[model samples]
Target chain A: MTYCVALKLDRGLVMMSDTRTNAGLDNISTFRKMHVWEKPGERVLTLMTAGNLATTQAVISILDERMKAPEEREPSIFAAPSMFQVARIVADTLREVIGRQADSGQKADAAFNATVLLGGQIAGGPVRLFLIYPEGNFIEASDDTPFFQIGETKYGRPILVRAFERTMSFEAAVKLLVVSFDSTIKANLSVGMPLDVALYEEGSLSLGTPWRMEANDAYYRTISEGWGDALKQAFDRLPDMELPTSG
Target chain B: MTYCVALKLDRGLVMMSDTRTNAGLDNISTFRKMHVWEKPGERVLTLMTAGNLATTQAVISILDERMKAPEEREPSIFAAPSMFQVARIVADTLREVIGRQADSGQKADAAFNATVLLGGQIAGGPVRLFLIYPEGNFIEASDDTPFFQIGETKYGRPILVRAFERTMSFEAAVKLLVVSFDSTIKANLSVGMPLDVALYEEGSLSLGTPWRMEANDAYYRTISEGWGDALKQAFDRLPDMELPTSG
Candidate 1:
């Protein structure tokens, strides 16, 4: 199981993903789920994946390999003219990989499915977020639905629905995502720490290094413990439930 | 679809459920999911249902009919000697109901399946809570677990996990459950308002009048809006996520 979330805000984009990957309770490993592509000052694209490790890694490897040798049949994400084109490249690559897996007598739609979250700025294009489905179709987030979460999403969703704001600062957005992730990590063991986070300021063409938070990172700890204490306090403040006079 | 939750606390039990039932998005209706049986100073038992409306309603109608005339093969739940026996009767009746549906060429395990949360106290037994499964098996809530949620549970679970206290006041428990249910209602259309809630005080031997919160109930509104605002305030107070000078 996995959890990856990305927000498209007025200021920019805030995206993060948990690092835990597991086939079962007995088998678990840490693997980075966020990928970055930067042509420094020219274009930057971030990709986050959740689903079968093999298929996602295969798609990433194929895209990365394409970048290494650009004179290929499929245009690399690096060469896409717009954010929409970049989404198309990623979706097509994901579909192609799943196709090969299906060709070998595998049920790629269910067992080997992988969904990707692509968000970034491409030169003149606006900062955008797209959720690419396992079927290769994709949907872009709009103001009404400014965020997208994949994998193990239900437990962490109510908080986001209650607190999200379009005009929140990049810093505030990151803080919100941290709280969301913390809630998910506590409710679900399949999503663990050592999170991969990337922030893309609107119009920043180049992707910079992202900060990774381990299990005990101070800021993450503050969000985790502080949010719990705050919730208790807030709970204490709610209007008391009155006993009914009769049924 | 449905959402029902039961908490076994030191003081007593607090249980609530949404009334929404649907075969699909287009086919939705309101149906009560909480049932209470109180024998004055003798005993009080509350049962909450979730899953197939047909199966759950059938189970309830059967139990009600049995109580109307206790000269039957299966003992009436009202005549059960202990909370454990109450659970057994409910589980067995539930299993039988599903079996009957299956015999009529229905898919009893999935489409017609139902889960029940039974909580109450009898003359000599301790206050107890049991989660009855579709197959007639049941599990009791312990000091550690102390709660059970059936149907559309994940969206409302994190708050329960974060704020639940075994020794809290009955009022506090109700407040917590209202918060949990409000969150579920906001995130899921299948779970809606006009919630039915039952609170049982230990040794009361009878349930007092339960409370039902409509969509615009004042206290429910306060908790719903207050919690959302309080969470936003808490999010604002959390330590800021510092952006690295380079990222």
Candidate 2:
């Protein structure tokens, strides 16, 4: 299982993904789930995927191959005119890879099962965030639901539901997201450390210096400790029940 | 869907369950998930069920019938020698009812799925909690894992993971459980308001007045508001990321 989350705020976009993938309990390994496509001041597109690793890798590999081809007629993430077209290219590539894998009998039940969080800004348009589904379709985040999460979502849902607001400051949004991720990592063993975090400032068509956070990263450690201590203090402050005495 | 949690602490036990049952998104109804069997000083047992409503109700009816039949050989909740035995009885009854129903060919794919949380103290035993599986086998909570939750459990798991301690005060335990329930209800529509809360003090052999909490109840409203505000405040206090800019 994987956990990836993205928030699109007025300041910019914040994306985080865990680096744990497992075929089974004994076959656990680390795999970065975030992919970045950058062309300096032209476009910067970040993709975070959750689902079967093989299928996602295939889709990424196909996109990379297209980018490297000298013929250059095929539309690549680098050449997409708008963020919407970039999303369409990614979805279509995913669907094609899934169809090919399904045609071959090598993969039986593991047909393409991947959801992508696509967030970035083009040179001219606004910064946008989308949740692309497995069937090659997508939905943009609205004011009602300001963020999107994929995989192992429930454990971290309370924090998002309670703290996420459209008007929230970017600093508050990032802190809340880290706390949410901390809660998920504590409850589930399938999601581990060494997180991939990327931030894209609005109107800047280049990625923020991405942070590769390990288990001992100081900010994460502080968030974990502070959140735990705050919860305990809050628990202590709730009013105690007044039990009725037996006459 | 449902959310039921029971905790065994030094002071006593706390059990809470939401009352919403939904067949589908459009077909939702309210049915109490908690059932209590008490014989004053002899024994007091509280059972909370989650999963298929029909199967859970059938098992409960079977258990009730066993209590009415004085000639029955095996012990029922009222007559069990220990809380452990009571859990086994509940699990076995659930399994028997499910098996009988499935054999009748009324449903396919084992529609007989339900889990039960049984917690209470017998006259001579220590306060205990058990989580009974659909197969009629159960596991008792220990010092390591001193609580059991069934139904939509993930949404409320973070609070218990952070706040629960074996020596927690009864008042603290009840309030923590209520806050946890509020979190679950907020995140999942299938688990809703009007909760059933029961507290059993050590050596009391009978439950305290069970609180039927409605959406507008003063204490519950306080918890909902206080918890949300506390979380937001905590989120705002966490330090923000210090990004490294490319020179």
Q: What is the TM-score of chain A alone in each candidate?
A: 0.96, 0.93
The candidate that wins on lDDT is 1
lDDT by residue for model 1 over A92-205, one digit each (tens)?
Answer: 989988878878976545778899999988777788899999889999999899999999999989888988898888778888888899889998999999999888888767
DockQ, Cα level, model 1: 0.69
> Per-residue CA lDDT of candidate 1, range B1-247, in tens?
7899999888889899999998889988999999998898888989999988889999999889988888777689988788888898899999998888888875535777899999999988899999999999999999889999999999999999999999988888888989999899888889998998888888888887887889989889889899999888877877777777444
* Cα deviation of A8, candidate 2, in Å: 0.2
Which docking band does candidate 2 fall into? Answer: medium
lDDT of 2 by residue, B1-247 (tens): 9999998887788888999999889998999999988888988888999988998898888889889995889666777788888888898888887788778877673656899998888888888889998888989999889899999999999999999998887777778988899998888899998998888888888777787888998878887888888777767766876554430
- What's the true lDDT of residue A184 in model 1? 91
Cα-based TM-score, every candidate: 0.97, 0.95
Q: What are the per-residue Cα lDDT tens digits for candidate 2 across A1-247? A: 9999998877788888999999889999999899998888988889999998998999889888888883778888777888899899999988877777778876664545888899988888988889988788999987777789998999998988888876666566667778989999999999989888887878778787677788998988999999999878776766766543330
Model 2 chain B scores worst on lDDT over the 10 consecutive residues at: B238-247
